[model samples]
Target: MLTYYMPPKTMWSNLSKETLRIYLDQAQQAYNDLLIGNKPISVSYSQETGAKSVTYTQANLQQLQGYILELQRTLGINRRRAMRIRFR
Candidate 1:
């Protein structure tokens, strides 16, 4: 089975932008999979001295979303909708 690694959030700024982009892509793909009824998504990440695997469930959907947003923000690629209002 192929596995993807998620770098620690604290290390995001230090990672090369290319690496960060790869991570962001992985995160977004996982999030999309979960949204379409995929369950128990697995992601690996380094913790302390070793790598650990985390399984994300439907219950953790929001948390996954937060990760996506955080990554997007870090990459400065988050899409923000602009609104305009006019009153006469």
Candidate 2:
């Protein structure tokens, strides 16, 4: 007779199915928020290689907030959730 069997338990087995599902859902949402909401806009810029070279821009709080707002609207996610992913 064949002795085909499954593997031993894993760490994830410690968590209830419902709890694991919720955690997975939250994690997926957080990742989606990051992809859609985290964008860097030009808050400042300076030329390092003279005017003929490409410009380098700085990112700051103001540009981050503006982009977050735009992303929230576009993604249909709440401001808090977007901010959580950004700050986390």
- Tens-place lDDT digits, model 1, residues 3-38: 544444564677678876777787778888898998
Best by lDDT: 1
**Residues 1-88, candidate 2, lDDT per residue (tens digit)?**
8753332354344445554445445434444444565432112212333322221123344434444344333333452322444554
RMSD of 2: 19.9
Backbone clashes per model, in order?
Answer: 0, 0
- CA RMSD for every model? 10.0, 19.9
Tell me model 1's lDDT, rounded to 2 decimals. 0.74
Best prediction by TM-score: 1
* C-alpha lDDT score of every prediction, in listed order: 0.74, 0.39
Model 2 segments more than 4 A misplaced: 1-8, 38-88
